[model samples]
Target: MTPPMTPVCAKPRRRRLAALTALAAVFAVLATACTGGGGTAAQDVQDSYKTLPKESGKPTDGGTATVALTPGLSPNYIYPYPPASANGTVIARGLMWRSLYRPSGEGDQIADTALSLAEAPAYSSDRKTVTIKMKDYSWSNGRPVTADDVVFSLDLLKAALKESPANWSFYTPGQFPDGVTAKATTPDTLTLELDTAYNPSYLLSMLTLLYVMPSEEWNIARTGGPHLDHSDPENAKAIYTYLTKQSESQSTFADNPLWQVVNGPYRLKSFDPTTGSFSLAPNKEYSGPGDSRLDQVDFKSFTSAAAVLNQFKAGKLTVGTLDSSFITQIDALKKQGYHVYGAPAPARFDPLVLNFENTTNNFDKVIARPYVRQALQHLIDQGGYVKSRGVYNGAASPNYSTAGSGSPYPPEFGDQAPYPYDPAAAEKLLTDNGWKVVPDGSTTCERPGTGPGECGAGIPQGQTIDFTLSSANTPAYVGARDIAFASQAKKLGVEVTIETKSLNYLYTNYGNSFAPANKDKWAAQDYGPLYLAAGYPSSNTVFNTGGSFNLGGYRNAEVDKLIEASTFGADPTVLSTEVTSLSKDLPVLFFPTPHTLVVWKDTLSGPPSSFNALLSFLYTPELWYFREQDS
Candidate 1:
């Protein structure tokens, strides 16, 4: 019975001055937001890496913070496509627009830390220029964050080829896209040069993921607003064809004043998305120098993880993402004390793209035999689906797909990852890939099913294998792929069907079309989990089996030469051992990584850590507050 307290939504002071002029087009994508450096993980309270980590376990002020949201998504396009896109819209766009770069945490060098908001960039000895220097600060609506608004939002993310510009992640502004030789050598000084010789620690790590802007309210929104001008690159294929037709409209992100921006420290004061709820407040013209003890916060939105556990058991969402069936009722919510926090949600090792020139299946001949998709990864169960999904224990890990970022799965892919679960080593790698068992344990197909040019139609004869699951995901991903096809894949013969849709027509008409010149317009996608990103060649927009972020059209040639040699690797640890041998072979059916579970209200606290929806929930909302109004 824990969920009562909730407040927020009072706005109207002339819509907080038109929400402070809709935060000037979120600094017009803040000179293309990509910065890095100390935003948390302890740093003497780093004070303001935009927002989050100010009050820690105490420091309340005047109650009010409801937050839970969800329902045809939006709190005005919250961090639109990166900065960890969604975890309650990255904590409501990290309390309304943030990114000048922040992310060191562990409390930056500790000596009571928290005070480096700026001071990390400095490259040029032919490592291809860099410079940066800003941090004089001043925006919630006071203006003036400069370094020419972080080099005009890094020249509009090097004019939108943007794979990961959080300032330099090893420089690939599409290899200097005939631009970003940049300037603004003053107004807080900025530089950047480059023609080659990459990684000045990727522009000092885009200050923990750069997001700054305001150079004339963002180069007058590169003119694509009413017409063309964002400096005009022949209007980049007509503003990506008018934001792909207003991201496919429904009144495009509520009259897009570029989804109401603010430049962090809190401000978006009202939202409803038919009740995913929202409201934030603080910026009485905020400019940083501390003094915001929580005036109002509210955020609701719950459609079932059993209505966020029947609103935590008839209480009404204590606040944000939860339910692994509430971890054995947390000893009755800690004998009614109610801080119950849980974990597990941290998966995205993202694989599953198999167009085999447009599917036909018996699980498309055991995913075209990649060691029988590495013997269905030793019969996956991942600790009984992370204890039937209630999470928190070792907060999830097992994501193998050919490991990356200096590989060897070190200190990152935990909870027994990459290839360990083992059902007789996946029935000895599917009877050494020829496959035949058949006495009762079903197997058969020792090659030879499809005729007309190998594996594609009518697919059957039974030893069983079938697959397909995307009826537009999230009823907890179609009940965790219908309990991994009725509890651990029917003794490995496997069968799954499902198809359900309408998550806005599966994320804008069949989740980024992999290659279906109209196969009844998509919805057969069996599993989902992807993020194969760490910086561009962007696997030719996600493994070029046919680009447009290739949702499925898989094609292999040795997994496209180990995803193009793990995208420009001089050895990011041999590209993390080729992303863990391409996820122990099952190009797709290697599930179990789904962890985003966050639940709060122990009286609010902060800085424990975990977020990858590309991040912004003010990247740390100044490490939370309100512990019974500071003790």
Candidate 2:
């Protein structure tokens, strides 16, 4: 049986909203929320070009930096590939094991060549064969990271897929690592032969997720056993089984010798099981770029956003994130000697996932119509939400496309919303398409025909426009928007009942594919945000027909062709084309993209690029250091 699914919560800004404990301060933030973004209140989603000021005085070594992890997203597993229930692998994966390619912090680029394990790939004339040259990096055991290790990692990943696809959420059957075969041409080179040619950009994006493991020390099936040929399928399976079993024993994570073989800048030093907090020490054998001046790095976790705010107020944290709920405390934080910066996370979009497979009340047929989806999209007041005191409080950006706001691959429609929030337009579109307009009352289909100005086929004449929207409970903005949407829908004679559920519960039981019995139980779900590959944000397994992650059973032949072209074809512009089509079609309802607000003490400093990585869900604590002797 397949295990329960766990959605990756990338953006910490929307992690959890604090209770309104301070009524006066909440109103103050709302008053200044409209500082900019006139007319539509749709502020530009582009990143701030202003670089953070460098720390004053000489840099000191051997100091500790206490970094705050996302609230409730504490790390529990040491393995690179974690199970669905794994809490915070995104933080652990990047810091413990380095991927083959480093995800670019910027939105336009696919990979960061400067920090990657391998140089840029050289494609063959036919574009089916590719060669990768490994950089000068070493494992914690003082062994050189070799091409054989990359191939060994691939073999084990294949074994994991054979055991269960749920082991890796990104794995879609027959795509990536399925038709691809790897061979170590030399100690410094690894070559891959692909069954079909793929767009170089798409291929690089996939490589960003492949974390390399130490083959020399990790090739055995059991502790102190003789090394086995990891290329062999059976031996690879045995080794994977051993490592996976070891990962489940969280108590031994810091003590296990297998877990300490690190290629990245840090190695596991200690772990707190009860609180899910962990500490890392600099790897003496780490051969990657950047200086490891800090003696230790600690990742602290919290149960609520209010707890995090209290820590910030007490000046207890060195570097951490400030939830938008505490935007009113910005001036206070600045007075307390902290720097605050924020922007929309790259390749991140907040969408209201619609269930086209839900056939309850003829919703399948009613939602199949283009005008209905467009009308529903108009009901989402993105601007109002950002400015509202109860919602984002202007710490968010208005996004209209899947490519996300301020994306390099913006649709032809650009920032201009194809379906802006217009109540009259929505009502007119419904009435023009043969639905009786009833403001604040029940609206039903009056004309039932497939022709123009008629409710499409399978929709009965008396069918009502009604559906239940299941919203995530923690992220206060999600519930706020759901209520606003339901109220807007009510004005148009549409009944949208709101139901709240935890994020974990929704991920486990709300999916149409996993819970077939509950297909008709939900019509829509707002799970906040979905993060894609850093730079190349392709919607292959998201909107494509029969996609593994296609929870709502959305199907469109044109979208399928467009996604294929972007995945296999060389032209990068095809991605914009695909997003343009989806924007007009409204595969999923779009919402405002939340800004990732990062807060840190003025004494703590690092390269400006280190702060940029926070937006992409990657951390570079190895380069961070204290500026003054007493910091």
Candidate 3:
């Protein structure tokens, strides 16, 4: 769900902590263990960016590059504002879309579409108004990208929020436009006035979410034809529905006028629905850096990792991510003229999230108990799961906090896990809590109470520990991990029914609050390896009470307070303490954090030497180019 670790929430203020000593040792061991077959060669490549082989002469003007897309991956919505946007859609949009600031190779912001937009925004004396200046760039249709376009995009977003409140996770309804307004001071300047001061880093990072669109192309009524009257409720809903429907229907990519207008380096030339393959031709009118060296670039999708690897071996693909299953084959690939780069650890962490609002079977009452959640964590063989998953080698480690172990947050915040792999400890915790343990059958609550050896209130006697465990069907590894976890859980007298669902279904129907009926159906879900945006490790959208991505509906007054403080207060000590508290609280059972592995042909150049695989690679496709041939 959420395109394999794509974060679903809005930006929140991040926490900071100093470097941790213990974490460094653990990472060393895990990294060594995970890179076993491929030896130090792969790890060396992974630790830093490996430069592409240099050409002897000047670069050639034009060629076509072939890249790989995950199978079954297609953009259902090319527009970025929609809540249902996927990785495929983001990649497709990146080719034609232009944001005010693009992430550099090191994940720092640089003005790409906007020339010298703002380093640190100029705030008013009251610190409530932010003014930004735009660059002189033009759309493919030769219209200057102006401050009106920026203001228009925000207006469209505001209307979209009214139509679908769940879609815009960044701004709170009524609170958004209450005092916040965008004004075009000049054709090249747009000023944002806020009623209250917000965290500067959080506010600036949120700008990346805005993808400027030609108001002329999108803000039109179904029948009125080319009108920007979003102020009218009827017109706003109609325009949103029209653009959304057009994006969903991709029978012919080139024929759609809505998809033709662009500002980025590439334009869509062909799309094959049957194979999920598409080709993009360079935009001659593009104003960004690294002007297209390739005449056309084709993205090929394969049903399985094996299919992708096959193409790589045949030299059909110029660049592609090497799945964990193919890690051991790096040596062979190297001999075949392929350069492997250790993908930076993705910003995601796989966790088993228990629903706290399941009233259907009275299971919520049991899950509400802190001891029950803790025991479930102890019962999971996290180390074993990581080893058996066969992806990322043993590089994956047991994580407990919402912030990933590899995240920028200090390691000490997540260094200590409240629950480790100890079934005996698990059984003891349950037994001490009034759960009648039956090794192979089911554990039932024997004593309900507020005293020792008693279950929490509302949990009736004889309520068995049985619930369905749902996970994603693809990746093959997640299913394996779920099966193993269920088997291990059985040893603790826990009854788990495993159900595998598609990624989209898991995220939309089960994980998202928008799908209440489906959300109520599951007890525990293990699909997402949820991620946060680079440089921002805020869990406001995922863990805070009523968060859009708070799939489990967890509510803790203390956690809610801490989340609010971290966002508005921005105190590192408070943030560190909050993470430590969560580690002990065990809101969700966290699994190991896995490393991303990418391999490409030696002939390709221009990819950043180092970048966060999950967030950076796809967002900056224009930097990539083919190496000049040594003819």
lDDT of each: 0.43, 0.79, 0.63
Structural similarity to truth (TM-score) of each candidate = 0.32, 0.90, 0.85
Candidate 3 lDDT at 595 equals: 49
RMSD of 3: 7.7
lDDT of 1 by residue, 214-245 (tens): 55543432335554344454443344334323
Give residue 188's lDDT in candidate 2 (0 to 100): 96
- List model 3 lDDT by residue over 1-631, tens digit each: 1333443321111111211232233334433443342344223223332333342334556777788775434444456566544223443665687655553323233223332223346777765888888766677887777887777777777767766666655444344443568888998888999876655544554565566777767787563476757646577677777776665566755668777777777778887755557888877777766667778888886655778889989989877766654666777898998777653343456778888887756778888888888888887666655564233444345677766655555335446666887888889889999988889888888887868789878888888888887766545456555665676678788888776665545655675455666766898887747655445455665677777667788888898777666655535345556566666677678776654556666666663442233234453445566667777
Candidate 3 stretches greater than 4 Å from native: 1-58, 83-91, 103-120, 169-179, 229-235, 343-346, 389-392, 395-398, 411-414, 570-574, 607-617
Total residue pair clashes for candidate 3:
2
Per-candidate count of clashing residue pairs (backbone under 3 Å): 106, 0, 2
Q: In model 2, how large is the Cα lDDT of residue 275?
A: 74
Ranking under TM-score, best-scoring first? 2, 3, 1
Task: Indicate the residue-level lDDT of 520 in model 2.
Answer: 90
Pitting candidate 1 against candidate 2, the one with the higher TM-score is 2
Off by over 4 Å in 2: 1-51, 54-57, 83-91, 513-518, 629-631
Steric clash pairs (candidate 2): none
